[model samples]
Target: MQKYLPLFPLNLVVYPMEALNLHIFEPRYRTLINECLDNGTTFGIPAFINGKLPGFGTEVKVTALSKKYEDGRMDIKTEGIRVFRILDFQNPMALKPYAGGLLEMLPMPEVRPFVMVGLVERVKTLYRFIDEENTFDVNKPQPYSYQIAHKIGLTLEEEYQLLKMPTEAERQGYLIQNLERIINTLQEIERTKERISMNGHFKNLDPLNF
Candidate 1:
């Protein structure tokens, strides 16, 4: 579906079903959130990475207006609904404080059991090594790969790539590859640390009795 949505560009990627809490302080954004809350509407958060705005982002809807300050600032909770590709960005609409953009909603693929299982096991190992083994729940329904992406130490660029993936299977594959690379790096670091530690330790050698 193609439609116009209020755009919030940030240096992070939000995945579907992910909950995000935002503090609206800028006058533009404050106005934007207020409009959405008042009208029961949604907004698109386009990925703003490395000083550039990406073509894709997730559409999110406000779930709660947790606080409103006397200065017109707000604390709101929102959940991502789906991914959208920006068609064109528009400056603030007439009499509006924030910007709006045309977007094409993308098709979200169904979960692939094989991919999910493989990635889940790899992530389990990763967490165990890091002593955060209980951080992720594999049995949870719709445990999409992004849920564990941050836990696996994926960089913002890597996360953006996962967000751009056309299917959950592809995302799972990406996560598995990423986790393997990170795990191998961590193991290497541990070995290096062990070697370094041994260098300063006393080697107990029996004095030769002449």
Candidate 2:
């Protein structure tokens, strides 16, 4: 079925089962939120890569909302409900910051449990590395898709490819491939570090007295 949705173009791709928190300060998006709350409508979070919104996005349900200021600013939490292909966009006028769109929901595959678990584990490994290197907290509840997607550091383009995949298995395969690449890169870094340490030890050796 086809329907129109309020569109929120963002720099990140949101996957189904992922939760996103957004600060709503722009007037256009504020209006969009109000409309959704009033009418029980879903919104499209089209991925904006390199400053352009992609043709496909996910439909999001507003799960929570709180007023942040007297000037209409809000703090909101949303979860992805389904994927959507944008058919058309109503461009923003001079005063509005958001766009509206016509969209159609894409079909989703019934993902097998094992596949999901594999993807989740791959993501966990990646996050562990990130936490160790960057001091990022590791105890937060992981979002099913974010773990897989964030681990490989997928570019916006690569993320779009995953979103366009027709089956859950295909998406998992793509993630696995990326994860393998990440693992290889980490191994290479470790090897280089070890070689550097050995070189330092050789330099520290006592000078030969001839």
Candidate 3:
């Protein structure tokens, strides 16, 4: 079944079960948020690249809301519900910055616990390295697939690929491939650092002169 929903395009990719915090200041999106509040409705979040919306997006539930000012601005926290594919889009002639679209729900496969656990472990290891190097501070390990996806630095295109996968196994496979690549890249960096250190030590050695 296809239904029309208000669309909110963003530069970042949102996955199922992830939480996002948004500040609503634009007039059009503020109207959209108000509509959702009035009707207990959900909205679609599509990735925007070069001002173009991706065909696939996630439906999100507004879990928390607060009015920010007398001007009707709002601060909202939302969690992703499910994936949807855009069937059609309509852009009114008005000056609204956001776009609205007709969307069809995408079916999700039951993900296995073991596979999910493995992926989580991989992400944990990656974050551990980040914390050790003081590159970033993530409070705790994320508990769900979407959170893991966000932490792994997946591009919007790659995230769309995950959303399009028809089965849990396929998504797991994709995550595993990305995890392997990340691990390899980190290892290469370590090797390069070791080589540089060794060269510096050799350069410092006292020269033997006859």
Q: Which candidate number would show the highest TM-score if scored against the true structure?
A: 1
The TM-score-based order of candidates, best leading, equals: 1, 3, 2
In order of appearance, the predictions have TM-scores of 0.91, 0.80, 0.81
lDDT of 1 by residue, 175-209 (tens): 88988899899899899999999997889989999
What would the per-residue lDDT of candidate 3 be over residues 156-200, giving only the tens digit for each residue? Answer: 688777777766667777887898789778879989988888874
Error of 1 at 51 (Å): 1.1
Candidate achieving higher TM-score, 1 or 3: 1
Once fitted onto the true fold, the runs of candidate 3 whose alpha carbons sit more than 4 angstroms away are 93-98, 108-121, 132-144, 202-210
Preferred candidate (TM-score higher): 2 or 3: 3
Ranking under lDDT, best-scoring first?
1, 2, 3
Q: For residue 194, give model 1's deviation from the true position in Å.
A: 1.1
RMSD for all candidates, in order, please: 3.0, 5.0, 4.8
Clash tally, candidates in order:
0, 0, 0
Compose the digit string of candidate 2's lDDT tens values, residues 1-210: 788777889888888767789999888889989888888888889988887776888999898885567999999889887788888888772345678788888875343223456665666677676664433222334333433565468877898888777666677788888887887787788899888888745365687899
- Give lDDT for model 1: 0.84
